[model samples]
Each structure stands twice: as structure tokens, then as C-alpha cells.
Target: MENIISDATRRNWDRLSASTDGKLTSRANKQKSLKKIIPVEYLLDTAKIKLIEKICESYIGYSIPEIIYSIAVILLQSEGICERQSVQDILLDFQKENSIDLIQIDEAIPRFSHNEDFLGALYQSLLSEGDKNKNGSYYTPRKIVNDMLSEFDLREGQCFLDPCCGSGAFLMGVSTKDPSSLFGIEKDPIAVFIAKLNLILLYKDIDFIPQILCGDFLQDEVFFGKKSSFDYIATNPPWGNKTKIVSNLIDSKESFVHFFVKSYNLLKNRGKINFLFPESILNVKSHKVIREFIILNQDLNEIHQYSSSFTGVVTNFISMKFIKGIKTSVIKVRNKNEEFYVEYTAFQHTENKVFSLLKPQEEKIIEKVLSKSAYSLSSSEWALGIVTGNNKEKLKSSDGPNLEKIYTGKEIDKFRLREAKNYIHYDRDSFQQVARDEIYRAKEKLVYKFVSNKLMFAYDDTSSLFLNSANILIPNVPGMSTKTVLAFLNSSLYQFLYEKLFGELKVLKGNLMELPFPKIDSETNNTLTMLVEEIISEGKNNQKDIDEIIYNVYGL
Candidate 1:
């Protein structure tokens, strides 16, 4: 379809919206509001004038919603497809509405038909964002759908499904010669109507007809009757944030996991399921159980992740594929042509932790360090700073008797601290969530940028308070002192290990706990402590001295 909508009938379609003056005001609002839950791509193309005319002939005097629904029912029934009893009941309810102005299908059909997705685009412009979020409905972009189709080679006569088929984009993307074997299941009545229309038109040129059932595919009935029903399934299920987990096995309460489990159960033994999911599934601690299940039971294929792939939504996205009954043995990773392959494995030993995957040499080096005496960074004394319930009310710019100098992540660098930008009015009876008050009052401590792109820690002997952004850490390692631990954290080798083990921009405590710290001898620890003193006294950014000491300590 062409991009531009010719001026001949744009006004009529625009005026069909709610605020516009019209005799069919209430009915127009219903159609406009219905647009939010229905994705634009799932709606059938309205550019075919002849197809529209033929469809309008049978619905000459029906209401807009009724006309569209009736037209779809006629097409599907003619192709020998049956509607569920519940859907048939919905059609019965549509017969009772007496539309104020019965649509003049002959006169308006031409205006509604355009060179683009005329009806879908028109509905999107008329609806609001709040309406779109009503049902956790988000239409997949064109390029994203294309990329998914490219990854799978659909063979003729293979049974396929879009379990949550919104407007049938996946079904339409499949250009297989046989549409008779294609299938889909959708719970939304409006979406089911639109999907049927899309498939009807898509298969109009061929002898094939698709079966898109209007029912929930996760029901026990579906499992018993339709188990192992398809060879391929592609869908973007609803991410119901407010929904609670019905099954206790899933650690997280997200609705996507339920959809994945249901879809997997319905697939053939060797079938593949491709989906677009929230990025949290890859590394979030809450999803560790599901991650283990997929890795152990399924042949995890590939993952393409990105931040903010959806224009209006703030969540990150990842595209992945899973082949049923296949366990991953060999894994490789690389970022080629902007595609990042997420591989969290190296050598024969690996952990189910975020960013644990490393390059060959990096794995060898970390293994060598672990082979010797060492401990996890968790053994160190660490405490998060005070989280002021209301920073504006509790924080003061000028120093007072009770106010203590505080620093944020921005005021700290490698082995040195910068000038204070703010101060916290500390009191025993203050409105602060003091997690570790003793750590806040300690005389000698090490502080690092709580939210840093890299490891940035500095030493402070004065008992200074810090904001939550600059967390405090005091080492309790038997052989290493506070200064030695600070040097190791700020060294180049530790920074490299950190980035390889956990690539998160924010240096969360979990990332710190995962770092493998080597137990250096007394001489090595003393040398690192002396280098730390030089870097702090001179206030220089040079890290070569400290880095060399860390390298020798690790025997790198």
C-alpha cells in the first residue's frame, strides 16, 4: 500500500471519530475505543477496492462493527471453518443493536479503502495510549516480524500456529503455498474478528483456507485435545504485569512464562517456538528457575536483544528461539553487524548467572585464578548507604553541626575522592531508612560509585556519610587490608573480569558478589597498598602502577 492517503476521503474517515459532530456518535466511539486493544498489523489491509466492494455488498445496511464481524463470519463459514459456541453467542448479541445511522456501505466503502493500512492507521490516530494499554496489546513492528520469519524455513504442509495471534501478522507473513494447515488461537473477540478477515484476504488468491480459533490455547481442554498439534509456533503473548502466578513452579509472576509453558506443551517433540520477550528473562534473578528449565530441557538456539525496541514502551526486548527436547552442548558468541549473541558459557564448567560467559582466554585466566587460593568478593564487609525517604527534606547544601559531608557516584574516581557536592543532615531520630548505621559511622572505609559503567572506588579515612549512589565497602579479608582491596577493585584486571562476568552498567551488589578475588601473598598485598597510597596522595589518574601489581598478584 502507498504511504500517502489521497485527500478525496480523508476528512470523512477523520470525522468518524468520537469528538466529531455526527448522528452516529456513540457507535463511532465504540469502534474508536475498540482500536486500542486491537493491533494495527492484525487488521486486514483495506487497499483492495474490489475486495471491499464485494464485502460491502452483503453488509449494505449493517452497523460498522456488525458489518465487519458479519463479513468475517460469512467468509470463514463459507471456507468450512466453524466458530466456537461462545463466539456464536457474541454474534447473536450483535443482532439486537439498532444503529442510529445504518452505514451506507456503497457510499463509504471507496473512502475507507486506501493505498495503505487505511482502517488500522485511522483507528490508531483516533485512539489514546491509555486505551492501547488496556489489554497488554502491542502490535509488532514490520521489521521485527520480517526478521522472525527470515530465521525459520517453513516447509509446505507443516502445521503452524500463532498461539496469541494478534491480527494474524505471523500467519500472513508465512507465504507457504498451503494455508489450509495454518492455525491460530486468540482470546480477544475483536482481534479474532480482525485476524479472520486478514487470513481470508491473504488466502483469497489460493485454494487454501486457514483455521483461526477464537479460544484460549492455555486451557486444560486445549492441552488434552490439541497437544503436540503443531510443528512451529510464533507469537508475542501478553506480558501481564498485574497477573499472579497460578503455578507455584514459576518463581516470577509474569504472564509470558505461562504462555511459553503452554505453547511448549502443545508443540511436536522437535518443534521450534520463536518469540519476542522482555530482556529480564535472560538475567533477572527472579526468572532463574524458568531459565534453567529452558536451558536443560530445550535446545536454546539464539537470542537477539536490544533496549527500547518498541517506540512507546520503555521495556527492553529480546528475540529468541527454542527447539523442543534439545539440550545445548556447544555455545559461541560474537557481536556481528549489530547482532549481539548472548552466550553465558565457557569451558566445561559454567554457572546459571548473568554475564558469566567469557571469551576463551578470559575463561582460562579466571580459571587459573580460581584454581589457586581465592574467595568471592562477598566475603568483604559491604553495606548500602542510607536511602533518605525524602531527600529534599532531609538533605542540606551547607554543613551544620549535625550535617555530615556526603558524596554521590559522580564525586568518586579510581583511588581518589573529589569535592563534596551535598551533605546529609544525620540524626538518630531521622526519617531515613538506615540499613547499616554502623557502616555510616565507620572511620576508615572504601567507597565506590554505586552506579558506575566501570569499577571506580576511593578511600576515605574521615567518617563521612554517603548518599545511596556511593555505596561503602570495608574489606574483612584475612590477608588483604582495606587499601589493598580498593586497589584490586580499581585495577584493570578486575575491571576486565567484572565486564566479562556481568556487563550491567549499574554496579549492583550482585555483580560485586560474583567477582572472583584471588588471595595474593603478603608481599603482593603490601605492594598494592603502597601503590594505592601513591595514587591517592598524588591525585593522578594513572592506573598503570596499581594494574601491574594486580596482574602480578594474579600471575597474569
Candidate 2:
């Protein structure tokens, strides 16, 4: 009997692990394929989604929230924790207006019932991407929840809260000795109901109610007088939400900024705040206000950057932790492959208070480069390329009457401009966004790619017009000629400096003004000009000699 039982158990495990192709899969590959647990995978599957959508279509009069409420009712009933009437009474606390008939899907209960936040997952999946982006609602994966929770050193009896909780993922991950200690505030009412239900299922034996509120964290009355209440706060605040809330703490339009400033107010002394944010929070110019607030106000503890992103979001993200106290002098940073520390003072020196995660050697190099700087491009004249609102109608590949060649970023190579491929009529009034006539018709100006990871400037004397992808820079350096300044801008040394200092893909005029221009003698300037002219006249990138000269000027 023992031998038979062992064989049967082995066969059952094999069956469970086999793929649709009848091949045994590795555990890692299987887990990766699922991306989530079994219950979540079931909800995300195509057949189940179609069934839910079909039911919604048939019940045309019912709304999505009402359908989701009915599903939650059935989920609770299947758990045997509460009867249908009891579940309905629990949902009433959320003030839901209507609910659909559960009897319509009576036979499908087994397929939908699971030990998970099934209703929340269904509602999120059903929502359009446009709506989700508008609200900045992206459900955090369980793996990320577990990873972020591991950072917090929790103690018994400490209260935890997730300010922008979506279906209680962070709250669910909080390992509190008392379930009631896990608190959350979410704006979505259906999500609030599901969060409470999930907590109740997790702690079925407990006799306490879950303190999950359904209201905006920024404008709700519940958060107005709740300063210094929570021992810990962890959340993924809405990204790029444009809802304006009046606060003098941080001046920004993004919703995440508003949520962050408010969360700081609600933390107890020595309490921690762990937030997952878009990578822009680290270095983007527009988000500088919050970075300043953090540097001036709180104890910035650590930053953990991740390469992975949410399902539809293209932006990479990072997680940061803060304590409610006087900020220390250094912040710990953890990347995928290494860990390091950056001085808090370094951010103060930067114009935007950007968090520059650099190695000690790289930081020293930047300091060395900036120390010998005598001038910057801030004195130069800058202009953007033309922005033809309707490019298809305005631009033509073939030439016609009054058509002029316009260069794009792809046509602007280092030290030389490639032949123009796009033709447009140079009508100043017809374009949506155009530079002044004199700027476009300059005798000699350097054009560079507006969106680039590195510098790609080309000297143009053809009085050329450029599309929006290219930008014009006419240098105003006192000691250097146009070609000499072009040499430094196109050199490899400046590329390294630009990438380390700004760390932005878009080459904005503000960032360009920060690049240091070392004062050079007339002889050195003339030598650089001759080298740049050689490369341009030959139409070849003779980068070696030109880069050497600029490297000597900066003493790199």
C-alpha cells in the first residue's frame, strides 16, 4: 500500500506540472508563464473574460459596479464564510446603488470562486486602458508586493496604511499580528468592497472589521486631521494623474505628488514610507518640487530601482523609502547588480535637486569637469525646429513650387548634416510652431537632435530649415568661434559628461545650458576650428584629433 501511494503521488505531481504540449516544464519557466498565482491566471484567461463580458452584455441595464458586486456576493457565498444576505449587508457599507441577479451565473460559481481577490481582478481587467491611465490605476503584482513588504521591519501592534491602495494589495501583504492593524484608503468603491472582503477572508476567525475606506486620499475628510497616526505607509501612488489639489508643500500638477505630500503628514515620528514611482521621480525636471521637499523635510533612507514595469506602462519604475525625521547626509541606492551610497549634498548642488546615482569615481570626474568651466551655453541663442501641426498634409517627399528642403534629427550626424530627404513649403504663417525667420535663416548655426541619449550636433551654413526633431543652437561664446564650439559639443568627452550629469533621453535647452565651456586661448580655439572644418569638409567623422583637443581643455 505504501508503494502504491508513493507511485500515485508522483504521477499526480507530474500531471499537475505538464504543459499543454504534454512536455514537463521547469519550475522557473512555469512560474514565469503564469506571472501570477493560479487564481489570478484563471481570472485573466480568455474564456473566463468572455463569459464575464457576455453576462454584462446580456444584463444591458446593469452597470459594471453592480455586476462586480453580484460577483463578489457569489464569491463570499462560495467561501461559506457568509450567506448571500450577510454578504449583501457587508457590501452596503460601501453604499453601492444596485446589484445584478446572482442566479444568472449559478452554474459558473465553481469556475469563478477562488481564494483570492477575484472580483477586484475582474473589475480591473474589464476597465479600459484609457480609463485606467486617466486615473493612474495599475494593479501591483503580488511579487512586487512581497518584495516591497520585505523592506519594512514591522513589529507587533504597529498600525500600517496604504494611502492609494488598489484592492488592498499592499495591505494584504502586511504581516500584522492583528488584522485590524492593516488599513487602506482607496477612491474606487468596488475596490474598497473587495479589499474589505479579501481581508475578512484572510482573517475569517477574527471578529474585527477591516478599516478600508472608499474616498480620495487627497480630498477626503478622513485624512484631514489624521496626522501622525500610521506607523508605516506603503503604496504605489497614481502616476501622471492631473487632478489638482491645493497644497503649498509641493507645486506640481501630477496626482502622485499630491498623494506623497499628504502621506508624509500622516506618518508617526520615525515611521517609514515606501513608495513605488515612475523613474521620472528620480531625475525629471518637472518633478523637482517633491525631490526638494524630501531633501529638506524627511529622512530619505533607500532607493531600489527595478527594470521591470507594469503590463501596459512603458515607463520603468523605482521604489524609495523615507522616514519622518531630519534627513541624513547620505542615501543608500540599490540597483539590479550593485549597491552604492550618494551624498545628500550632491542633490542640493544640482539645479533640480536630482538624485544622481553615480559611482564615486564618476562623481569625481563630473566635479573635475565642472571645476575648470568658465562659460556655458546659457548665453547662446536657441530655437526649436518647425512644428507643422499636420505633417502629412504640409510635408512632401517630392519637390514642388516654393518647396524647401527640411532636415530632421536623423539627418543631423556628428560634425556634418546629411542631405535633406523631406521637403516643405517655408510658409511662416502656415506652421503651427515655428522659430523666428532670422533664427532659421542664420548664416551659421549648429543643429542637433532634440531627442537623443548623446550629443549629435552638425554645423550647418546652408540656411536650412529643420523639422521639430532637430533644434538650432547658435553659440555666443566670447573666446570661441562657431566651429570651435561645435567641436566640443560633438566630441565623445562631452557625450560622457552629458549622459552622467543629466541622465535624460530628451535633450532640453535647460540641460544644455548646464554643460561647462572651458576658457581656451586663441591658438587652441583656432586648432579646434581647423579640426572641425577638416571633418566637415571631408564629410567624415575624424573624431580622434577633435576629441583629444577638447579632452585637454577640460583636463579629463
The lDDT values for all models are: 0.62, 0.75
The prediction achieving the highest TM-score against the true structure is: 2
Score every model by TM-score.
0.77, 0.84
Q: Over 4 Å off in model 2, which ranges?
A: 1-62, 83-88, 92-96, 106-116, 223-228, 388-403, 424-433
lDDT of 1 by residue, 179-205 (tens): 766788876655665665566555554
Per-candidate clashes, comma-separated: 2, 0
Instruction: Give, for candidate 2, the lowest lDDT window spanning 10 residues.
Output: 30-39
Q: Write the per-residue lDDT of candidate 2 for residues 382-433, one digit (tens) a residue.
A: 9999999998999899888999999989998888988888899998898999
Clashing pairs in 2: none
RMSD of 1: 8.5
The local lDDT score (0 to 100) that residue 395 gets in candidate 1 is 80
What local lDDT does model 1 show for residue 484?
86
